[model samples]
Target: MPTDIAFLAIAEAQQLYHWLPAALELARRPGVRVSVLSPSDQLLALVASYDPQGILRPVRLRRPPSRPDSLFRQPSRLATLLLNYATIARFPTLVTTEISSAWLRRVPGFTSHLILIKHGAGDREGGYKKRHADFDLTLVAGEKDRRRMIDRGLCTPEAIAVGGYAKFELKAPRQRYFYNDDPVLLYNPHFDPALSSWVNHGPAILASLESLTGWNVIIAPHTKLARAAAPIVSHAPHIRVDMGSRHSIDMSYTMSADVYLGDVSSQVYEFLLHPRPCIFLNLDHRDGAGDAFAHWRLGQVIDSADALPQALARATGLQPGFVAAQEAAMQESINLSLVPASQRQADLILNFAQTSHPAKS
Candidate 1:
């Protein structure tokens, strides 16, 4: 007998990278079967690329039907889950990167142990949801999340594992979006209307970028926002706008950028992988002291897009002043270890499965 585990890639494609490595790792071990369930062919194709030997199974889920006249759209998380509830309930253990999967527990006769691998390291309140407590086990990137989740009563210390950042295991070659040696700035805004600076000041910020001399700009908003509208156009030669592309999610911008600009996106933590300059937009003027805005302390938080010029002007000169804080925050936000995060997470899952429900000979 073998333990069965299913990894759900049911959310946005951007989230797949966060948990796929662990799935691949689990598949390699003996006496465990690993399957990846996804509604998108593109996502399944990606899984196949990672598992060239076909050790892991890729199960293409049936998506709910859409209106024939409707434009192409990815199925909503709830819709995907509801449509595939029966298939999902068969597994003894299930792992996913998002919280919506918690809904599966509501299905009649559902008894699978739910595991959550948080996708981002940001300090947004949305990241700490009540539903997190429902998971049998939760995996996070670092102590920052482990502490916060415990403080918020979202999970007990025993139920949570600090698995480092699984997304960091993904390696993408850095791309040069601009030819010159000018500083490249990555403007990655979250898609949440109430929290993202893009919802309010995006166009103004883009317009202002044209006036900034000797700086190359990359406008890569969250994938959700990119899917909502037509691609943004930039007339300025120094500005490169990517609504959402492989480069946006693959760390191409985060790895290559010299300066980071955004509101409440977790990509800032990704950018801090190198401890570069960062300027956050506090356009809505949220409380700086709140736990949700804790990441704001890592950089300059400006209240308006009008300050963009001055911020960029002084970014490099001020970067040295923030290096220590940035490094400390990065360490707190992501636990880097000699062992890859994927391996640690895979090991934890294996231990949990065998102990929770051992297969009888």
Candidate 2:
């Protein structure tokens, strides 16, 4: 009999990309049926785009009719899981990118083995929740997360696997966003109010970028943050502000930009895939001494928006000084291997599904 495995996409659309590659890889194999389940039509469409041959099944999960529509307008992560409980419970094994889904294990009749594929490689405390211990298996990008989770008692070494960064397996066609050849700088800020530089210094940073003469700027904040705020507009010809578009999530900005400017976004590690110039914002006065801020060691960390111009000007010249550290950090954050990460992740998931028992409520 074929094993029934479903990839649950209850989080943001950005996370779906991280799981799709593995789902497609698993679907291609015999004796395992992979299905991509989502509440959003946009997400299902994205899966269709990737699976042109219709290999992986697409299942659209619906909100319960008894639930009030207003309450579900912007459903909480837990609510989304609860509302779709009946449909989700049918699968013998379910894979999700967010830890919030672990709550499902407590629901009556929800006996599916819950597997977590961590969505991001950032070192924020929010990423390592106590709920992680509830999952039957967890997959991480590299040694950094594996060590952190074990040390924090979030997951046992046997329950977690360092399957590398599956998101890197996704390939997006490169497109030029700026007309001029002037070096492009991507300013990507995290959404967390306490840790994000944009919460306090966003306008000033944009204002400072306007005065820059030789560089092009792309103001693309984290997708969650952009969705919450009103649409952002850029009047200057040299500056473009993208408030959550497909380009923002598809690695277009990261692959195209020559320099990176950000707060605590994991996208910086993606930008580091090429080892370019990077500048970190420490406007929140975060202590730069811990493992959480380990990425800060890769570039110059500026405390104020006033230092923007000078930092950009010095980034290229200072890049050589940081290249070795950046390379080492990238290796530690994402374990690149001869075998594709998607294949490794698929193998892990398949093995877990065949061997692991259903999670207890």
Candidate 3:
């Protein structure tokens, strides 16, 4: 029988975009029955468009549009687990891009090989956790993660492979929030309270930008940010506060924006794709040295909310001096080579899966 592999998109349905490229490529190969499964009709439809002839499984959950962050994912997980036995028996290699995939290891009658292709490539410490190293195989973004994981004794060198960001290969049109020719700015804040500026400086920063007539601000925060507490609403003509819009999940806001205003989100790297002006909010006073906060060194870093206006003004020029840093940071985050990263990742998984047998739990 052909080796059966399944790509699960339960954690973050929108994040399903990250795995589609590789999954589509895998489905085209011989002796592989690739399954693209998700609880979201929207994501499943998008996945089907990429591989119309392949299998598309939409596992209905108790929660509509079920995602790891959905208001009620516990019922979804419980229901999903109840249906996992048959799935594991057929598809022994289960691939996922979320850390929560580790939960599947405990599923009854499941001895599948769990593979992880992480969602983002950020320099933040939260990205490197002990839970991530549990997967049988991890498809990392680049050298930064691979080196750090091995050094931390969290991941074995043989168990890891560098499979650039496949989502970057997928097509997503840039979205424009404003009609006129105002320069766009993205104020993306991370969800971590200790590290995020959203609590102490996000509102103040928005208030400052409201008076600026030239720049249009998109205050899109990490999706989980609003879940933990009350949503921050914006009422400024020059600003658009998006908690978790399609524009936020896709690279729309990042591509459309001219200047990047962020603290520790990996989306900053996506914005750096075009090498625009960047202003980072350093509310926690993180060290710019070493890999812990290596991303902060890419652009102008401001510690106080009061400095945002001046920094944004100066950063609009994007200073010619920051070009080298932007290029360097972009390199560390992704392997933007001429070759198609999706096909490379698919081939790697195909080769590995063909050789290994399913584990018996």
Candidate 4:
């Protein structure tokens, strides 16, 4: 039988849009045939569009429209345990963002390798300990995250790393393009109510930006913002809130923007790949909460809507030394490159798939 590699992605719209295609390309090497198994229509379209020749097969799983209590309350490990076995039966190599050790137990021919790409904060790795078991390899993009995974006994030292951010491997530019005609500010708010400025101050921020002149604002919010009932800036001439319908996950906005405004979303890290100045919003400064990014000391962290205008002023007038420092720190944290990150990731996946054999027991 031909070597088949299956990539399981979250049913969520944005995750599918931004993360899935990169994984597909990484898997489509000489020995492997890649398939994307996801529930989001956006994901299906990306797979089809990225490889119209049917080079990568797109498989849509039947999933309930409304999220179930079990899945919603406890995601990551448990959710992966429930949905991944079906994919294991058809494909020997599995690449996923969320992997459950519990699911690995039940697969009939389960010797296949699993490579997990960690996409969130370091704190989210707590559940991995409960489901801990052996896997071929695991990749992480953040150093703090790699440490947490190691401390939790989730995977071995060799299996984890502050590996390069996967999206860094995708489309990138030789040098950041900054247009002096008008400063471009990209606002990316997290979807989580407790962690996002959009949940609390989006309307106020939108209204404030609407009144201001000069800076061009691109509100590329979390994809979930598209379906939010109390959504921010439904239709604004100046704002471009991501609808997820028309946009694919290109990081051009990150490369070109002069400044970034965001909450606790990982998109901020993506924006930081180019080492631009950013402003972080602190909606709830619940002290000792231990969201390390909040204390990252990379940029200004503001606590109110009123401070935004001044923050924008400082961002626009950033000194050359300050810009250099922030960019250097961000480079150490994200470790991105325009040339080889994705291609190396692609090579790793293909090499693993070719060398590993199926389970005998």
* Candidate maximizing TM-score: 2
Once fitted onto the true fold, the runs of candidate 2 whose alpha carbons sit more than 4 angstroms away are 64-74
Instruction: State the lDDT of candidate 1 residue by residue for 1-361, as single tens digits.
Output: 8889999987777888889889989988988899998888777886787788999888988877753211123578799899999898888899999899888777767788888898889988888888898898899999999999999999989899999888877857667888798889888888888898877776787777777888898889888877775577888999998876668787888998889999888889988887889999998888877877888888898997889889988888888999999989989999989999999999988888777752211
Ranked by TM-score from best down, the candidates are 2, 1, 3, 4
lDDT of 1 at 280: 93
- Model 3 worst lDDT window (10 residues): 66-75
**Candidate 2 per-residue lDDT over residues 1-361, each given as its tens digit:** 9999999977777887788889999999999998887776667787788889999888877743432322112346677788788888889999999888888878777788999998888877878888999998999998989999999998989999988887777756556878879989899988888788887877887788888899889999998778666666779999999887678888989988999999889999999888999999987677888776889999999988889899988988999999999999888888888899999999999999998865766
For residues 1-361, could you state the per-residue lDDT of candidate 3 as single tens digits? 8778888766644566678788878767777777765555555665667666655444443344344444212225445545654654466788888776676666676677878887788887888777786788888777888888899887899888888888787646677678788888888888888777787666676667777777788888887775564777768778888776666777888888888888888888888878888888876676767775788778899987788778877885765879888888778778786777788788778877877666535
List candidate 4 segments past 4 Å from native.
16-28, 39-42, 60-87, 100-112, 120-135, 142-144, 161-163, 172-181, 225-229, 234-237, 246-248, 286-291, 294-296, 319-321, 337-339, 355-361
lDDT of 4 at 349: 64
The 10 consecutive residues of candidate 2 with the worst lDDT sum are: 65-74
List CA RMSD, all candidates: 2.9, 2.5, 2.9, 5.1
Report how far off residue 290 is in candidate 3 (Å): 4.3
Q: Report lDDT (CA) for all predictions.
A: 0.85, 0.85, 0.74, 0.60
User: What shift in Å separates residue 206 of candidate 1 from its native position after superposition?
Assistant: 1.3
- Candidate 1 global CA lDDT score: 0.85
**Alpha-carbon deviation at 180 in model 2, angstroms:** 1.3
